[model samples]
Target: MKITFLGTGTSQGVPVIACPCRVCKSDSAKDKRLRSSVLVQLKKSNIVIDAGPDFRYQMLREDVKLLDAILITHSHKDHIAGLDDVRSYNYLQKRPMDIYASVRDQETIKQEFSYAFREYLYPGVPVINLHNIQQGIRINGADIEVLPVLHMKMEVYGYKIGDFAYITDANFIPAETMAKLMDCKVIVLNALRKEPHVSHYNLEEAVRVLEFLRPEKAYLTHISHLMGFHEEVEKELPGFIRLAYDGLELDIPNSWSE
Candidate 1:
């Protein structure tokens, strides 16, 4: 399986509009980030996680010709805003896009894209099939485990597929969710910045969680300009953990034996 980091920045993204911070102005490509999202490719399926506002460009940049499903983490705009663009795939594939989300999130989607659900639909509105997340849900033969964590008081889902796990926009991870992630070989988590955040883990807190989980390799995502330049911040992290960047890809074996 292969995983591509579609975008690794926070809600506002790196180089936040009109800001003059050094990390924002850095020349390195790693410093330029879009809102956090990822594409997971399996032998027979392509899945995307969290199609934020940058989803269209992220898909186009990756030249993704086929998409099987989308798993939403939460209803936050940065995570769901670009869902309307799925109409492109609806047109090409001649089928409604399958979207998996919690019951609460499904309501948000209905409200945000009300036209799609109207009795009389527009010619080009995105056609979506909303599926409520449930236990033992499989997509194209891949087993997905949902890990629920806390983004402050709100619940956000992190997904575990094969031996890889991804969690973002979370500040507190419940013990049950931590248990689910304990066996993952590679884990991705959000680290908003260097300081404390009420709703997201800061760099130091993120490191602590990773250390406890002790994955073979870990990545930090949903970064902010305050995280400092990628190169500089990288030097401070444990060798096994690195900050994720847009367009980065990873190949994972079905098992560690590979």
Candidate 2:
């Protein structure tokens, strides 16, 4: 399995409009981020988690040619805003994009992109097949497990595929959900900043979760400008943990257990 970090920034993304924070102004490429998202390429599957506002550019930058499915983590604009761009794939593949999401997020998608769902829609509208994910789903020979977590007051879902798990936009994870993460070889969690926040995990809180989970490799994503420079913050992380940047890729062996 090959995992790609498409984007790693918070909702507004790095270099927020009209803002002049040091981290935002940094010249390093690592500091420049799009919204948070990732693409998971399995043996015979290509799936993306979270479309976000930068979906179009992320795909273009990566020169992606095939996308089998998309998994939505939540209904937030930063996560689903760019879903409309899937029309490009619809045109190229001649098939409806398979979209997996909770019922609540499906409602949000319907409201946000009513034109696409209209019975008599335009020919160019994005074509999508919505699948409500309650327990788990199977696609292209891979089984996915949905782990529920909390994003402030709203409930969100994290996904576990083989030995890799991804959880973002989450502030609190229930004990049961934490248990679901057991045996994961790699985990990607949100770490917004050093200071605590109401709707997202701070660096310390994320680190604590990593310590408890004890994944062989842990990456922090969904970063904010307040998180400080990537290099500086990375120096403070444990040896096995690293800051994920756009375009970062990791190759995982077929074995789910190490």
Cα lDDT listed for each candidate = 0.94, 0.93
lDDT of 1 at 230: 94
Cα shift from native, residue 222, model 1 (Å): 0.4
Model 2: per-residue Cα lDDT over 109-187, one tens digit each: 9999999999999889998899989869889878999989998999999999988999998999999988888888999
Q: Write the per-residue lDDT of candidate 1 for residues 152-182, one digit (tens) a residue.
A: 9999999988899999999999999998988
Backbone clash tally for model 1? 0
Model 2 — TM-score against the truth? 0.98
Q: What TM-score against the true fold does each predicted structure earn? A: 0.98, 0.98
Model 1, poorest ten-residue lDDT window? 249-258
